[model samples]
Target: MSAKESGRNVVAGIGVRGWLRFIWRQLTSMSVALMLLMLLAIAAIPGSVIPQKMSNPQGYARYIEANPDRVAWMEKLQLFDVYTSVWFSAVYILLFVSLIGCILPRIRVHYRALRNPPPRAPKNLLRLPAHAQASGVTRDDEEMRRRAVGWLRRSKRYRVICDDEPGGALVVRAERGYARETGNLIFHIALVGLLVSVAIGQLYHYRGQVILVQGRGFANAQVDYDSFSAGSAFDPASMCPFRMTLDQFDAKFRVSDAQAQDFTAHVTIDDNATSSKEQIKVNHPLIIGGAKIYLQGNGYAPEVEVKDADGEVAFAGAVPFIAQDNVYTSLGTIKVPDVTSGDQIGLVGYLLPSAEQSESGAWKSVYPDLLDPVLVLTVWRGDLGLDNGIPQNVYELDTDNMTQVAKDGKVVTLVVRPGETVDLPDDLGSFTFNGVKRYVALDLRHDPSLTMVLIASIAAVIGLAMSLFIPRRRMWVRIAGAVASVGGLAKTEDENLQREVRSLAEYIAAPDKAPPVGPGQAIQEGKAE
Candidate 1:
């Protein structure tokens, strides 16, 4: 082939090969890993900036209510929920692939280096980073080589070699820290392991919360939970179904003081089917079958008893209410479908946990702990919605279609205390506030696959340590024959041998005689005087 044609073929081959090599190098480079790290950080930015759906779905609804336009814009950009965004997943996937690409090859390289010998020292010892010499090391050539090798060996540099040629011998040296390269590879791989572990945790774990009433029992089921969610691959059946039954909940607050610092709840829990009863305090919890139960808190429900004109028991139960004040609180309820000779009567009342009379005779709470607790009742004699399919709150009376008959024109609001009874005129019967009983709130949660996540995290740490703390290095040495140069030796006889002439000269320092350097140069120039 002609030179030009051959060159064309060679250039074409190189172009193709170089492209592949560039790709391989990029995949294996630390720069690529660092860039992936940056990408990962950027991907995580949205998770923190945007409220995750799992943490607060209703809170986002509130945000939407307040900032309709802003919420719309954020939703358009997937900011309201970014964790499940396609862009974030893409970033993590690409990072994982690149990390594996870099780590797998490093493993092979480390294995080979461990099994192979280190390179010999370089022939030119003076060219090394640090070098020194001493003619007094030894006079005999073999003795010199032995002494140099001995010095290096004693210094812990293994595999020291002595190379003897015509003129002299050069020493070769090496050490056993070559396995440092493997340590570096382990460190990198360990980081990749960490990433995998976190991804597993995100994909296989289950986390949610369930709020149950004090007397109620909540099963660790998806539908029973108030708000529940699992990882992408989590199985609902695998969730810890450790049913917890609240046997009893006890709460005692500090004596009606300014600061109720001594608030605590003692709970008795029955682990479902475990047949074991556990007592749990405010801070302590009972753990059974991977489920934990605690006395989270408690609230009061005013106990009321209702009766007809014939003294027939109409209603006798506790009505729970949310506290209005931190200490002093408000509790209220509406009663519908009161029967009187096959007719219906409606009643509404506001109960105060600690009822206190105001200057104007209006009733309100002075504290949360039912001190002189009272209820204000207003009765209406009409349709109590018993015929309607719509449900009514036992704590609330639907007065959408009822009329008041007790001391008012359609409605009346008043207060009643414990042992207090209010009679209904026009055959509406009566109701009484007997006392108050406290109710408790329970929260349950279950999560699976935390163990897998932890294992992956630990493996990643080990791999990272191995990869970072190791370095790869080698040295080479070769002793070539030194050629004799008689012509050069005769040309610089006086100048080259000047140091020897110092012994021949009487004085080491001279005032004249062309100084040692001048005469040495003149001799080289063949201009001897």
Candidate 2:
């Protein structure tokens, strides 16, 4: 329409380059960077509260099954994989860019400031915040200036420059504490290093979990782990070749409340280069083969023997029972697919350590120790669904196509103790409860960037301390025909600035009476003039 209207439209539009510049400035601001860091911490809360797919597959599956209506929405939002989610990655990348953008310009400015000298002294020293003047100086102007410069250089350890004013007065300007800004820059640089180290650790780390029954051996292979997860850059071949056998597991519980007190897993580890015996406790881990083995949990695995009706041993082994209660009430499953006749059988039941009969004629455990252990089970005859080529959880039994063994039109519950045998209904089979053994769940983790992360963390702490405690300051001394004046200025709110200026003025007035220089009295010296 009109030139003015077109110009107004153009100004309002803020063309592509202008908009880009504005966005970059906002993103690189320190306030925005801090906000993003806080947001990242908040976003990690979900990963800790909810079961992550990579870290806890079985728990994730159970959650999905328990909350079917919410599963679809949760998965759609990538809540099940929070750390690797698209939104999380976007935030992480933006924070990285913001920190780098905030650091580069500061580094350049600091470099230039380091090369240049401190600002010249002001005309009138008495106008400064911290100022002192000594009128009765016996020394000449040149002698006073030289003494002041020497005291600032040797005793106070400041960078000194001597200049003659146009009015024939001698000025000694001194400055110190460039290290304050250097420490600040170092802290920010170390922060960036820490972020990069963490990202690298995430990309190259691997973790696996396995349950080891007593006397059973395990190898460091992908197939040996019950559950395993690794970063995108991790390779299976990079795993350290190590083998270990569970010797024994010891657990102690308090007698009064049956609360567990201690747990230890004794193991023998054999790496390709060496072998050793080690004990892994709850907080103490075994470090070998570039991996850390942690004892995560402990439970009982009851040994059992199963025989078909034809008197043939069908199955036998120690079955791990997950503890469900404080007194060691555990649940487990046993499947017999090699039965000689009829159909497959599944024994689903609980093991009660220190078993006792309740008032209602129910079996329960009273203590965590194995004083009177018993097995209470129910027999089911059916297809175990193992031959269907689908993976199944060993801890669970699917009875959808199975029928419970019954006697006289009533369900039969088998009650057996260690070293006892019982007959099954309908002449199907015989089940025996053979003693119990302990098992331990172990988690192994390998991270290549741990050293770098540790060093960066330490450096960050040191730099932060320096930036907070060290003070940047400048001092000026002017001597003209027996009148000597001193002034001090600090970049930060320094409480001792006035005291320091007064002390310097007194020293300049009578250098012979000043205290001798000592190591404790020395401040950090800056570049020489």
TM-score on alpha carbons, each prediction? 0.57, 0.85
Put down candidate 2 lDDT per residue, 1-529, tens digits, no spaces.
8868677644467889999999999999999999999998999899999999888887887787779999888999999999889999889988999999998998899888777876788998887878887775656788878878888899988888888889988899998888888888788888889988988988889999999999999999989999898887889999989899999888989988999999988899888868789899999999886899999988889999999989899999999999998998999999999998888899999999899998997999899888999999999998988886545789999897899988888788999999999998878889989999989999999998899999998989988988999889899988887888888889998888887887787676664755533322321111111
Which residue pairs collide in model 2, if any?
Answer: none
lDDT string for model 1 (406-467, tens) is 45444455466788887766655677777766665544433343555566557656655644
- Model 2 residue 441 distance off true place after TM-score fit, in angstroms: 1.2
lDDT of 1: 0.55
Candidate with maximal TM-score = 2
By lDDT, who's the top model here?
2
List the global CA lDDT of all models. 0.55, 0.87
Scored against the true structure, residue 390 in model 1 reaches a CA lDDT of 43
